[model samples]
Target chain A: MSARSWNLALGLVCVAFALLAVFVWIPHDVSSGVIVQERGQTNVGDAMAPTAWCYALGALGLLLVLTSWRSRPAAKSAVASGPRITAANVRFLALLIFMLVVSLVLMRYAGPVLVALLHALGANVTDYRSLRDAIPWKYLGFVIGGTTLVAGLLALIEGRIRTRQILLALIAVIVIALIVDLPFKHLPLPPNNEL
Target chain B: MTLSLYDYVSIGLQAVFTAHPAFHVLGVPISMAVVMLVAGLLTGLIVGAIPALSGPFAMAVALPILISTFGFSAAALLPTLAFLLGVMKAATLGGSVPAILFNTPGTPDAYLTTFDGYPMARNGQAGKALRVAQFACVSGDTMSDMVLITTAPFLAVFVERYMGFPEKGALIILSMAFIGAAVGASAIKGLISAVFGLFLASIGRGDDQTPRLTFGIPDLANGFSVTVAVVGVLILGEVYQAIEDLAHQHRSKTSPSPVVDRGDQKLHWHERLALMPIIGRSGLIGITVGALPGIGSTLAATLGYAIQKRRHKGAVPMGQGAPEGIAATEAASAAVSGANLIPVLSLGIPGNVAAVFILIAIDTIGGLNPGPSVFTLNQHELNPELVMVIGVFVIMMLGNAINWTLGSMLMRRLGVLQHIPPRIMMPLVLVITVAAIYLQEGKMTSIYFALGFGVIGYLMRKMQMSGLPFVIAYILADDLERLLRQGFSASGADPWFLFSSPLAVAFLLASVVVAFTMSRNPIGKTIIKNADPE
Candidate 1:
């Protein structure tokens, strides 16, 4: 697709979202009421500004679609139809998403230790090599294991831990523990007594 | 308007000599502000010479540290703000050093400087290019600061005295419309993005009285954390872009040609005289754009260059090697640094990420509120906010003076060729950003918000969206909503309350005219055209 088509598609999406926000997301009471008399309801019962902004966005999207469509036939091949999604881009994106999911899932449950491990490993993903090559594994397992141990011990000693090392370790632990706790469907949010 | 020239001078003297004895230090006798300015300038020179650590990025890293170290009250004091302002100026100056020597601009604004800067370097005038850049940048920035010293407080006082919530609301809307029309690919796209920002900001319940867009999520009851959103979207998104570039580089097989040249960096009096017009013209252009919400230094640099090129009539050969080109671009971009504060200090709208970070630091670390309140004079107790505001102007001049004296000397030591590998720096930056976010909010949910926003920011970057307007909208969303709501409440829910005041009416009308006119091609081609990406 040309840039115009892409813009049109984006415009359509904006229209849909804006319509939903204006009509569905805003509370019915605020929209219906003449005066919002509730405590701290400074608008006294006004929800129009948000709804007005949504309508304006909807209108803008419509205009964008019209303009882009009008320009579409003339929009021949150009140097910049925006960035293309190459295989490398896809791989980089996938790695990022994987890291994100892993970090989020592990952040609450395992906290510091696991998260650090993931980050340390995740750092290599930018190189577009194999996951192993992304990070430095040249030092072998003992080196990794020793550093991980010292990192964990330091976190344990500090009553209020906020280091990156602690962050990664906690993430790693939680992901592992959650896999083990699949049947129970329960997880502890870091520094907790639950196993 | 009310005060005499003597009263103003008296207040200025008092602000310097006796406002706070705590500021007194060293033999020079200015205060901690001098120390802060020197420290900030050195830090800026080092950081800004690195392509990855631009002024805004450095500010992002430093903000949490600044706040955490200084605490709220101490952070608001003259020294800390002065340091931040100093860093901002020096960073603008230092960006050109790398741009000249390595052809890798330290910041986006420096991208234009490389058009002539690199050519000059290739011509064996690397030191001269650096010197020209330093002089133009510092002088231009100093000029803008002087303008701010006059205009910001005047505007603030007017707003405090005459504008109510209704007028304020109208002004914010006007600002939004103007910024939206001025930036992005198109006015429609800009407006849509801004509205989207508002929608996103609508999420969360803050304090006790506001409505929450939580959608029944317990974790989101407190709203998305600003620290997370800012860090994730702005800083981490940049990291992702860098990583993406790395991925592409790994797939390609190419080698870079290294160029080496150095000389004595000194400026002749005649050269300085020759470059003054270009610097002055570009400075004016930069200050005009910077005082508004959306237009940034990149555009300013481009416009300045384009105009100066036209004026020169090809006498100096623009892209091949021209001192005028370097001067025009550097002066405009650097002028923007000081002028960017005009809106933030007066109207409370941050034009770009740097201003956003500054706003965040001021709000978090400084107990004082910005906007018209800073200019409000207490008839009873002599408002400290006003005193602080004036002191801030004084610190800014001191920062500019420091830049004039020490900036080029510091830039010489930055070693532009000794580029830090992204592989080494990117990971450290990521870790620092995450840790900074965690420290700022002290909540796990805040981390989630940051990560989530980071993803959004990354996607937006890939999609060719300008983050400036979105950030501006997001930052101003609460203020806009609050003002509108307050206006409605005060007017007993009257729908036309915005038209009640002449000021409000004027703002609304001006907004319509500006937005419509700016959206047109003829005007857009005239005003607010951004430079093409390198």
Candidate 2:
């Protein structure tokens, strides 16, 4: 278990999945109205003070993962034996816990062709044991023909109609969140002339 | 200071001799040698022979695989500037192969190549210090890509004729006084991490009206994403200190040895022309501290190995072995890898930290806005000389052909990176940095504001702070608050008209004598008292 108790249980499950996406899966907006004149009617994503600074940095990364899982140290004597682990560090820790469970389960149902099939499963986990003993059906045809040829060529260049690859990946994520929200558009200052 | 030096030297040499033509198949230049030099030299030898992967995680998985290979032609913008010049010369010679066999430091300019590359690999002269760090990283990155194609169009026509805006805000206050007196271990914690990275680059939402610090997170109204805050403060704050130093360390069972004395000793061409005058004084202090942003390439390879150990007064100085201390710290951090893309290719100024992800991939998929009119605009009308001559010959021949073919076969396959330990590589680089911050905003609230700036970049690198001058003053704080609110509405609010020109009164008198000598930190205790001279 130690590897700092699986990195303090994967940093306390990414601070309990960022405190259930800041208190029970996001959804706010009860007319901000200056966060209901200082914290009253709340809920506009809990009167968004950066969702309580993302639950105060996920409760300071859950108090540095419960003080690095209570200052580990306990196993100071036990596992004296050797060689038991290294099958290339358990295939690089099972390709780093299957790329953190395939980016917490395929980033909201396949966005970047499951992030380029997690970079072709990190180049088949750095030649997964020499392509699983050289061309064993080309490592199951590169994990079923390289993850269905990178999710059918990024769902046929994000189209072959699955609601046109989820409406062109949600209109390429609302035109890159409206060109990174163009300097947070307040605009009005000085140049106002009512046209 | 309206100098326009002949329209900044005829539009910076017609933006480096307008090159284009890369696409064509059956008839070569095959996508500029398979997507800019063989898939950027196999993503710079698997992110520079993986420590916990580097070269900004092969530019955050090659910028959404070149933003899903955006519409070809205009010579597929020279394979995204030849995959950022083969991940900046295979992450600077694959960060001196884990500072020569696992002392570790895959890149923070190979932390002074683990002080003389692990004492010349415990003196087995690790393949003659990895062939003298691949001939001083391909002769200091082909003499800093021929001085960034002949000195960045004469320093962009001398900063467009004697620069202004108080000498570009005293050259970002003397590049945050040489990144807070040359990086880390305190220059008042690197000017309080470049004033907390210019207050997180003046928190998003600003084009004007006013909301200065979006503490009211409207998904930081397009604020963050300086390539997701430089892949969340330099690769998700080094995967939260390699998952808290891989759960305070383990994996031992000894192996890394393979010393093979490459046919017994070689170097002497008069000991490699006496380390070319300390690799031309650390490639002129790595092209002037890599054209200064938040002074990068690990403080230009620790100020070019502290001016080649104070110009070698002789006696075996520079951390013991000295092949002119690995050719002045690998030719001054590979002469700021093509002079840190000459201010992100002529003034869309993202000076360092991989020119802030190649100025957010030439403003998100070369739509453009990298400054001095991305070599004079004309967007859909196209021809900005096809992305400034195939982004300068595919970033100087994909950074010297990935330093002459996989830079010495990824420095002799750096002992299969000690069987990838860091507890299965820090939760697989925090699950590919949460699928690159949800492919840059397919929001789970931008993965909850990138796990709230990955827990404020892991408590500002566990309080030692200095997240390289707060991620280069929060990626140039919204172009320094929209050029200080368009120089205070074109002058009316005249704070002495930001010091009436003369390059903004010599950048407000050298940023008030470098903010009064970096609020007296005395060059971080004289570079850790001459880097541990003990």
Candidate 3:
């Protein structure tokens, strides 16, 4: 199939999706069913109405389809010179995509350390000759090491603070009672556990 | 809201560009604005010299977080804007360094410079070319900055005094149509990309603040963050393209070209004087085209080169190391950097991708909306935005001076970056983008959105579609919707409301004509231009 054919398919897909969004997916709010203002009912609809946008998108998609249909075929050699199903390019794209997926999933499942680790691995998968002799490894190591140590310390402090905050309730209550309640009977009774 | 012209003048000048008494040594005061302007200029000189780190790349990496820092206050954004302006100007000049030294144009506008610039390099006049380019670029930028200062206020004043939402909406549509028309030949493809962006904008919320298109995804409740959308679609997309190119080259076994350098070159006063006419003429042309929305520096540069090619017969021959060619191309392209802001400052309509980013920054990050309101004057107080623009103007001037003194020194050292391979650089860029996206919304979920858009961007590029219109359309979407809503709402939903105003009718008609002319390009040239917007 030609590029025009591919464009046609894509344009059709876009039009279908847009139509679905406009007619099926669009939700109605409390006052969406009516636009009557005589009874002092106004703005009873979505603040960012998508109807106009949806129709516009659908029209644009149709135009794309027509454009693709009418698009002229270029020289065969030019088309041949373009990106083909080559192993090297495919592998490169796959690796990048794989890294992106893995990093995104790790973000959902693990802590920042895991995510950072993945990011480092992803960034490190580059041309060896381009980096090895060009950059000073000693400097890179120091920068990387210093960054890791600082990040680790900050994370550790933050984790401790987060985990310990609510767990200190009993000590807080005891201290509060000693300072104020123990001195007098009718001292505005500190709200019990709600405190 | 009324104020005297004198009050306006002082407000424009006093907003931070002037020295403050924060610190003093022997009664010499210092201000952050001047310092920031200098810093920004140096940064621009450095970053702009690198190949493939184009305007969108710079803006995408910075805008998301930068918005948080100042939050749109004119006084604070002014310093940052000064620095940003410096970066932009320097990019136009610095891009030529690689074009001259290694035959690599850093930005689309720099592409034409390489025609003559690289020849100069091959002929052992690389240093001369760089010097010529530096002079031409800065002169062009200064010329356009003057135009912006003189024209923007008058336009804003007119808008403030007269027009309403309907007229603004028509003008915006006119601009958008021109954008679709200006980028490449296919109005269909460009419009398609734009519509896709608009559709993205429409998703996530309804007019009544009800959720739509969220599909019950909790993370998407607030919709895609601007940072995710812009960075993913623009930066990450470029990363994909870079990686793809490297992969192809590696498989094909293409060797990197070795750069040639000749030492000790100086441009004399005689040569500079001879090239003055070319630079001046190109600067004029650039300002004229730059004032129009959608047409950008890249186009301006190409036009400048073509015009000069016809007009002048210079020493060393045209396209064979001619300094006049470099002067014309750099002058015109760099001029657009400042002139691009004309519509943005006056009507809040951004003309190109860079302007779009700035406009978005103003709207989303800054509290003040652009346009006539920014120029508003009152009995009690003058508009701070007017003052801010003046500060911006001052910063642009300072930035130019810094670029002149510092740009030449930095040009020699730029080749150090040429050693970094795309394989290493693109991935690192991706990592930074992911980290930034995560930092902004504090969610891993938005990274996924960015990743998805990145794929779309890669596909758009591979399919030979211009990604610029898509990104610009996305930025303009919110403003477009707001104006459209206001206009339609006030007209009681009458479709013919726009026809009520003569300016509105004129703008819409102009949009139609411009789109028609732009969309009807020769097929081959159109294909080439399609890839140029990057």
**Looking at model 1 chain B, which ten-residue stretch has the lowest summed lDDT?**
B247-256
- Candidate No. with top lDDT: 1
lDDT of 1 by residue, B494-532 (tens): 788989989899999998887777757776755556722
Sorted into a CAPRI-style docking class, model 2 comes out as incorrect
State the lDDT of candidate 2 residue by residue for A1-195, as single tens digits: 443454355456556765664554433322232122223322121223334434544554565466557764546343222102334444533443343334333333343243356568774344232332332222232132223322332342223435443443344333333332233232111001010
Instruction: Tell me the TM-score that candidate 1 gets on chain A alone.
Output: 0.46
lDDT of 2 by residue, B195-286 (tens): 55554554544433434346466767567766666666666666655654454355467855654443445565777777787787788778
Residue A132 lDDT (model 3): 27
Looking at candidate 2 chain B, the ten consecutive residues that score lowest on lDDT are B525-534
Residue B441 displacement (Å), model 2: 16
lDDT of 1 by residue, A33-77 (tens): 324456655443335556666787888889889988886353345
Off by over 4 Å in 1: A28-35, A38-43, A46-49, A74-76, A83-91, A103-195, B1-33, B74-79, B206-211, B250-265, B313-316, B376-380, B516-519, B526-528, B531-534
Candidate 3 per-residue C-alpha lDDT over B1-534 given as tens digits, one digit per residue, 9 for 90 to 100: 567767766765666545443466686665667766666666666556677576566666555445444444555576556555666777777788778877777777888888898898887777788899998998999999989988887888898777887788777778777676666436666666776777787566445444556777767766787667877777788787776665445233553366565775798888889888999999987898788776678777887888999987766778888899999999998888788898988887777667766776666646456677766655567666666666677778778877788887778787666555444445445555654454445465676789789988887766656676777777777777777766766887666777879988998898777655665556324423632455
lDDT of 2 at B381: 55
